[model samples]
Target: MTRSPLVLLGKIWLALILVFLYAPILVMAAMSFNASPFYQLPFQFSTDWYAKMAGNQQIITAAIRSVLIACGTTVIATCLGTAASVALFRYEFRGKRILQVLLFPPIAIPWLITGTAMLVFFFAIGIGRGTPAVVIGHVALALPYVIVTVSARLSSFDVTLEEAARSMGANAWTVLSRVTLPWIAPGIVAGALFAFAVSFDQFVVSYFLSEPGDSTLPVLIYTAIRKGFTPEINAISTIIVTVSMAVMFLAARFSKFGGSR
Candidate 1:
């Protein structure tokens, strides 16, 4: 059987796109294990970079901070975004469309602008720059993604199921806990993972909101890069990429974003 010219061309294009997207990450991961400090290529494998990263208190501290912030952001954004999504799905209000539109600007506007605005707002309210401000900033940045993700999952949900549960003597809370949540559980998980990734990888906003000597991993990595790149940086970066990719991969599987059942 002969493939159509257009189909063959599309496959070739997709292959090129995949290479373009992933080749740099592959190279970076390779270099992380390379013995060369300067990333000298003809690679000699070693775990030295990983060892170096472990002892670096600065990186370790920043990494812990990053995880904590991401966790906080995920919890706050998931709860709020999920509740908001449910409300949007179940209710009709005068400003329902406008309320939905409000979620977009945090996403539509560039983060730099949003970050700077947050800096100003926090300062005006005396929150100042620190982990608190960073968490707030991250949640704001992550909320829209969460809302959109859960909302998409909620769209295909059977409202009649909830109605049936109510008819069968389930209260609102019971209906939500048993009937509604189970069906949309995958979407919530996907949304939470997305929030974690956004907070974990956030640099620009974190940079602006974080206090001196206290910043997230991405901000620390940027500072390290400016000092001069090292194999340890490559190793840590590889870890970050691996973790984020793994999370999004799981999220894709759960959400069936690729249309897999």
Candidate 2:
């Protein structure tokens, strides 16, 4: 069969889009290794920036805190968002639409507004700013992402398997735990990883919520950048970009929707 002109054009368009998106990252990664202090270099290569980043204890501490906060937010958001998605998709419930909309406001709201609201809410509730505040902020921010991802997976899911389990004397909880969970496990896992990455890379929320010593990696990077645009910042940025790409690639690879089985 001969391909149509429209199909050929569409393929070209997609290829262009992919190039547009990934080109900058490739350039940034390359520049991270440039030995020159300026963007226009004598083209020398060095690992000095990477070494400096490795020696920066503050960045390491900030990264550790970011991991801890991201883990907490991922756990909370994944559980709540997955449960909400499963319930909404699998069962008929009253006010389900309203609840769904409520869960998604964080995505709709501007990050600045969300950060301000979180700060206010935390203070009003007498929760002092720190990891606790960051946890709450990241959880709220990531819940919408989790809900969207899992719900999309569930939308394409086969419910007959769940019904079969129920007919075999499995209770609602049993069906969910055994049948439904396995089918959508990839989506849940992917969403959880995305949520963790979002929390890990978060800057605005952490900036607003964190105490003096509770800076996340992004916040630390920002502070470092403000001090001066050092080559070490490029190194950190390259590392972060590399790690994020690896994570997202792995998440997609493990997804059943991606045909990994």
Candidate 3:
């Protein structure tokens, strides 16, 4: 079949759009390896920063803490969000729409505002500042992601399969566990992975919610950058970018769930 000129033009436009979007990220990745003492354009490449980052105990510890907190947030958000999605999608209830809107306040409000609000709220409730508060804030933001992803998957599902399981002497729990969940497993995993990523990169919430001892990796990076230009920051950025990419790649690869095309 002959390709239309307009379609060719559209493809070219899209390619250009992608280049525009990713060009900055590519530049940052390149600069991370610059050998110059100062962070400037057109520099030599070196691995000193990477080596240094490997030995920096503070950076390493903060990174580990961030990972742990993000994982905890992911588990909590995914469970609660999945449950909410299941109930909202599969059953009828009063004020369901209102609850859905309420769930989105985290994403709807600006991060600075949300962080401040949480900080004050936690203080009022005597929740204290640190990992526990940070986890709560992250969970609030991440749960919306879970709800959106799982609900999208549920919308495409055939509800009667669940009923069929029930007809075959399966209990509600069995039907949910064995039938409905398997179908939406990909979305659940995708949502949880997304939640983890969001929580991992969170700066505002982490900064606000965490006390002195509970600084997250992003917070450490921010403080380091504030001090002065350093190649170590570049190394940290590279490591973070790599980890985020690996996570997204894995999530995309596994989210297909062996389902029909």
* Candidate of highest TM-score: 1
TM-score of each: 0.95, 0.87, 0.89
Model 1 score (lDDT): 0.92
Best by lDDT: 1
Which stretches of model 2 miss by more than 4 angstroms?
1-20, 254-261
Q: Write the per-residue lDDT of candidate 3 for residues 107-148, one digit (tens) a residue.
A: 889999999989999999999798899999999999998898
- Residue by residue across 64-150, what tens digits does model 2's lDDT show? 888888899999999999988988897787998898879767887778898988889889989968888899889989998888889
Give lDDT per model, in order: 0.92, 0.85, 0.88
Better of 1 and 3 by TM-score: 1
The model with the greater lDDT, 2 or 3, is 3
Task: Return the candidate ranking by TM-score, descending.
Answer: 1, 3, 2
Give lDDT tens digits, candidate 1, residues 113-230.
Answer: 9899999999999999999999999999999989999999999999999999999999999999999899888889999999998998899999999988898889888988999888
Worst ten-residue run, lDDT, model 1? 252-261
